[model samples]
Target: MIRALVLALCGLATAATAQDTAEAALRAVQQLEAASISLQEAGSGRDRISALTETVQAYEAGMAAMRDGLRRAAIRERTLTRDLNTQSDEVAQLLGVLQRMGQAPTPLLLLHPSGPTGTARSGMMLADVTPGLQAKVDVLRAQLEEVAILRQLQGDALATLEQGLAGAQEARTALSEAVSDRTDLPRRFSDDPVKTALLLASTETLAAFASSLAEIEAETGAPPAPDATALKGQLALPVDGTVLRGFGDADAAGIERPGIVIATAPRALVTAPAAATIRYSGPLLDYGNVLILEPAQDVLWVLAGLAQVFGEIGQVLPEGAPVGLMGGDLSDAQAILTESRQGAASTRPESLYLEVRDGQGAVDPATWFAYD
Candidate 1:
């Protein structure tokens, strides 16, 4: 009986040892998984930090560039003003001389009731000045043309400076918001990976791509944005500049398009005219990068001629939020293309083409946008 009791105690001891070993192994595995999860989180955090750093650097560089551009524009403006004033005085004097000559023609002067001596004297004076006067008149004409061109250039420069300053301010605000957030927002809509790949590969043209994108978006509806119809004629403009072309204005090709073209500063920021949801944001043919915003169920706003675009399809944007930036002066290739198509070259670097469309057809945006 003593031997049996000892054997039973030994068996219990073995069982306890086995249970402790199992528990220890399970804990080891759990610890490894936890460490792996922590490593993954660390990696993601680092990547986000890097991205934010890049964004901040870019904003700073943009601000510096805008300041330099403004300074240069101001100097040019002053010089043009001085030159124009000088040219204006010269032109006025030339005009007065021409007016006097016209009033007293040689024939009328020769018939002066004074005498032959008076006629000879007048003829001699006219002869002496005629050659030099004609030359001066030609010079004045050229100077006047130059002055007009300079005035136009100065106007454009001032406009560009204004737009650049506004864009820089907006960029700073956006950067501040991004820095405050630890996580970055997704840049675009998250579609099924396989379907998106297939659709992208199959698309042959911009139109086809747009159609496919529409179908995909229909399958996954977008979040609602604020309606903008009620704010018509009260909404602010997307950029700072003058309207280069009004809605329905005829192009060089004699085609009256349904959109307005705003001539803005080079690399100027384009903003949302009103609260809206992005429908599409990317390059589309000759339009360059474009952003399509849906301000209401039936209303769509299309902004084209962007050098770079921000945000993504299906993203909600508040009024005055930056959407993209206007392109710089045309490249050599672009210049060639423009000349070939229009038979003329343009000096304007950036032009934002804005089109508003409803369920029926294209609509004028001027009525919806504030001039100021």
Candidate 2:
């Protein structure tokens, strides 16, 4: 999932850059005629006006054509991410069926199967309780192949987007140079303030668009989550950071105890202490990017930091798959993660958050992890 998401984001970032380029080109086109007229009235050279006008018109047309394609690229990225997630889920179910038939995970150790027969043989016996389990597994294998194809498609689209962005940037550079060459024009427009403001606005607009896309992705449902029991003691600390608050820690005066706080820098990668499904993924009041992982019915874990998220909710994560990147941007607030509480105070921190919950209660993570 992390690889898929990273690819998706790379695509999105490329698209966003392309979109900005397109927008800038369009803006230049709109500004061209007025600028030309003004330059004419200001007694600018005919060649200067003509050059500016032509540049603007050309950029407008070029970027206009690229806009739809850029948007499509973004959409394609989103689609592939969503599809891969779904396929992974379907494949997992099929694997389950194979496991029941006593033929699951057939030696990927020897040779990776690329065709149907190898897949069928994998879950031949100890099959699932459900009918058509073998067929379903075959279908899943096929779908996995399809996922690979979609990934290639996504990569191609991203390349195209990158090309377009490069072209648009080149065009902008040309335009800026042209603008600079016309020295007789108003000097004020060439000042730092206007350019800075314009640049900021453009960048902010791009950031907002990216955030919107992320929100949309978040709204989408993910594949089947991992069982809490599956994660119990499967994960271990990856770094050393302090836990400012304990699981269910509250002062006698009623101050709430943080689930787990592992102090780390921005962009530190958070991983699952054990294999599990993400229970929560979002920024809570103060915890910048918080992830809750449940290791079992009586166990829950929380991870928080100031940074980008590495996984989505409901994602079945492995023991060390990046869960989130840590950041230190939010001051006076601590990021955290933990397992189900068994009721005790925790004293260990590796910049990784740990907590335990037993019967919906807080347990000291230190002893359980040490004992485990």
Candidate 3:
């Protein structure tokens, strides 16, 4: 029964190890490489932008998987090492007993102090003990092998990390250039510079500025607004992240804003949640690199806190189009690996603020975005 229990524990450990996260990371790397190839073969303008976008996203996913795999490997290694240390004395005693039994002559091993009956009992006891001893040995061997593998995995991951980081940086550069060169998107209307400047100079709050957006537009035969009512409660968040603060939530400063704040990784890709026309795309009062989109008449989606913004004001953007990137410096391979080994959370220090407005009133973004 003891042997059976030990074997069961070993089997469970083996099964858990079989779900290799390192392999998942490798698959992500392959995807990143494929995306890089696609970007190289892409045509100019939107085609290149789309391909570059895919490349960047792939690299991001690959890096995340790699980091997770490394962290798990480090944890597993520590656990196995600790277990081995705890069992060292017992293992040594078991080995000594086995060695003595093996060295004894057959007649001497079979002999007992109480003669025949004692010898028969001793034989039965040895039979039971042998299997349990073997089970422990097997468990120890398996653990050692896993520790070695985990170490190798961590060591080999550095190269993969470097590749992913380089690929992501290159993709980001290409995406920036492609967006800058793009000029084919349809325009809704040109923004009046003087009116925008005057509004920015006088506007005291985001709500007030949003309410007066129509006053600064220089109309140039704009198309009919698309109906986005069907997309309500179905729109994806503009960026991949966790919501740090919900709409109307008070901060440490006791200030409540009618927007949801999202925490995201450095340079994370930001995209449009729905097909929309860009009403404004630039610096706002206190928000950094704000982008306001009109998905439907009298409705606006505002995204802020970006390091860079894409597309010009008054241009129509399809759903999922690249909008901007979150702000922060990308960590190098060594730094990322060290952090992963230490089991720290991936640096998601950048924040994106999102606000939804219907007519003249701000509403909770959770009502529209499917964050859950």
Best by TM-score: 3
Candidate 3 lDDT over 1-372, as tens digits, reads 112222222332343363455455455556656666776787757767877777777667656655665666677788888999998999899889989988999999998999999999999999999999999889989999888877766666666667667767877887898888898788787757886788889989899989988555536577666567798998889887899999899977999999999998999999888888898889998998999999988889999999999988888887777999888999987898799778676778999999999988999997889985
Off by over 4 Å in 1: 1-223, 329-348
Model 3 poorest ten-residue lDDT run:
1-10
lDDT of each: 0.57, 0.44, 0.79
Q: Between which residue pairs do clashes occur in model 1?
A: none
The 10 consecutive residues of candidate 2 with the worst lDDT sum are: 332-341
Give candidate 3 misplaced runs (Cα > 4 Å): 1-44, 105-107, 216-220
| Models, CA RMSD each | 27.9, 26.0, 6.5
Give candidate 2's error at residue 216 in angstroms.
21
Rank order by lDDT, top first? 3, 1, 2
Off by over 4 Å in 2: 1-235, 242-258, 329-354
What TM-score does each of the candidates earn?
0.46, 0.30, 0.89
**Per-residue lDDT over 183-299 for candidate 2, one digit per residue giving the tens place of the 0 to 100 score:** 332111112445334443454332232222222222224333345453345445533345555656664577665345455433233455666655455654444555666554435
Each candidate structure's count of clashing pairs: 0, 44, 0
Quality of model 3 by C-alpha lDDT: 0.79
lDDT (C-alpha) at residue 148 in model 1: 57
